[model samples]
Target: MLGFLTARQAGLDDPLRLRRAESTRRVLSLTLNPDRDVDRVHGNGVNAIDIDAVEGRYMLSGGADGVIVIYDLENFSGKPQYTCKAVCTVGRSSRHVHKFSVETVQWYPYDTGMFVSSSFDKTMKVWDTETLKPAEVFEFEDNVYSHHLSPIARKHSLIAVGTKNPKIQLCDLKSGSRIHVLQGHRAEVLAVRWSPRYEHILATASADSKVKVWDVRRASGSVLTLDQHNGDKSKASSEAVNTAHNGRVNGLCFTGDGLHLLTTGTDDRMRLWNSATGENTLVNYGKVCNESRKRLQFTVSRGCSPEFVFVPCGSSVAVYALHTGELVTMLRGHYNNVDCCEFHTDYQELYSGGKDCNILAWVPILRTADVEEESNSAPTRAVGQASVNPAFQDAWSSDED
Candidate 1:
């Protein structure tokens, strides 16, 4: 560790090398933080969770009880242990509360002043953070499954929405209307995600066992329909016929760089793909036990070498290497099936919520070796330097005269 520090300080190693090493170690050391547990406010199962893109200080959670809660994750008590209390909530008594389960909740990418939530009631409502009132409402003919606003989009303020309807809706936040719809999937569109790399590129997953990538700018339809076989019809198995999965594809997430995409399905499998070409990179993440009939919410780690994907597996959160498909660890805290997991990239921490009506915080375990090393070396280094350096000798002078 000292050698690593010396090399890092001397500029002979990548500055991020130390950080990556620490991040990796921290990830491997992830443990349930009892001190940082969030207050259980939801009356029913939590359906979704999201950390804001801007400040990352506040977290949003939607529950099956039709409640939306915002929690302030910052510890202001100056104590080692502190509970993350709910700052505000759209309770059942609220007139603006969703009439049914809130399927998805997300903060506006650019600001925390606004947020959006979609529900099984067939409506997506945008709320003002300060007023706790709906700023805009999008009505649909079918149950809304999932929705997302591009964190990197500058050309437009569009929210990609998937629903029980096969068509994916793009709602314009700036114009306050449905901007357009992308049509390709044959079954209910379960998940929709905008590319982190290109503002116009979007990915949609559906119950029809297909994942399609569309260029919203082009009206001709999806640019590519992900096929496991890479168009090898002769060698294509039934499972490889222009489908991303063999069962309902319920989850979709892009890697931090937007160069790759990850999808999970009821087939108990997860696949990684090149976003540019839609070719299944075929990183075989074996049997990722998923049984959700609704959208599965998962997230990928950011700013870490060999990033990890955190997916809800039954009552636990499964952590796997993003590209290598190796299971890293299982966070087994939830008493019921975990519905959603959110990652805090800044601290490499994880927050997960589930039917158990609990939110668990997984934080990196702090290694004591460095602290011990510093403590053990401090006096020795000072004494050793006192012999040669006048500054150290003066600081330690017994004869003050």
Candidate 2:
């Protein structure tokens, strides 16, 4: 319907004629409903949010007040305005729960029974969702910034953890141990991500202003180091290594296809790059304010013709078109600086949090007609799920192999 509207609104009779224009972009926003009343939260602020990709109807949020809450994302109350209900929470009573701010939270890509959280207390705890207890805990020497479990790594069930130490530790889930460290940067490693396109590939953005792409299977050298000032067309071998940003690189997010990467730096810039080539695309997102001393948690929209990037600005979230570098619009609601944002492609919704002690939800503007048509066309699935992603493949390979 969107494509049809784009073509008909332009009075273009042919499909080929409709494909060339750049004005087809659309912007919409739906007000978010918080899990509790706006004044009810402990009010320390929200830190992290994780939307269940497989089910898409449940999510988890960790707060600076050290509370972990699960929310149901469905329209169960049959009201005009739907509220996100709190399904469960890890309250202050749990002795082993994180004592300080929970910096990051993520679900095991393949399972609903397991989730992970890292805190300023220097520990990463893996929890059994049903039992709501720490199944395994890994201690660290410094504050952990972020950690990621490879979405499609089947051979190696490892979680890559970033910290103030500048080294990224790969923890093996099955063995319940730290396997090995990937060391390079001289400052804090703020963000760590495994390539969705390749199992052994890893990318790290550091406080040192450098973004390094590594082939985890190799110990001899880095595969590529990104430099922003290098000529756009120059290959990694031809460009000067390091110097990707003038300051700390705060945000690291990959497009849904994982062929490209989006980075935001304290240098107040955002750049897109070819993930495989390690070459910058040179899309100029003008002076995006990234005050995050820690890496920013941004998300990319999926399924759109040209996807968009959602990033947290001062007290609002800015939406920008990928590849084109055009600012779409800003989402305004939070009173304090927004820290993180997550996108849910299945329902065309966005969830973002900040230091304002509130989590705001955004969605495309929907009419009574659109909602009715959607309800008539399909049935909504129950929140949460059984089984795991078959997409999981072992990523473990010995140096000899």
**lDDT of candidate 1?**
0.87
Candidate 1 Cα deviation (angstroms), residue 214: 0.6
Candidate achieving the largest TM-score: 1
Question: Residue 162 lDDT in model 1?
Answer: 96
Measured on C-alpha atoms, candidate 2 has an lDDT of 0.76
TM-score of each: 0.91, 0.83
Q: For candidate 1, write residues 210-294 as lDDT tens digits.
A: 9999999998899999987788888677656898888999999999899999999999999999999888898877889999999
Please name the candidate that would achieve the greatest lDDT relative to the true structure.
1
**For model 1, how big is the CA root-mean-square deviation?**
9.7
**Model 2: residues with Cα > 4 Å off, grouped in runs:** 2-42, 231-241, 368-401
In the predicted model 2, the residue pairs found to clash are: 154-393, 154-394, 154-395, 155-393, 155-394, 155-395, 155-396, 156-395, 156-396, 250-296
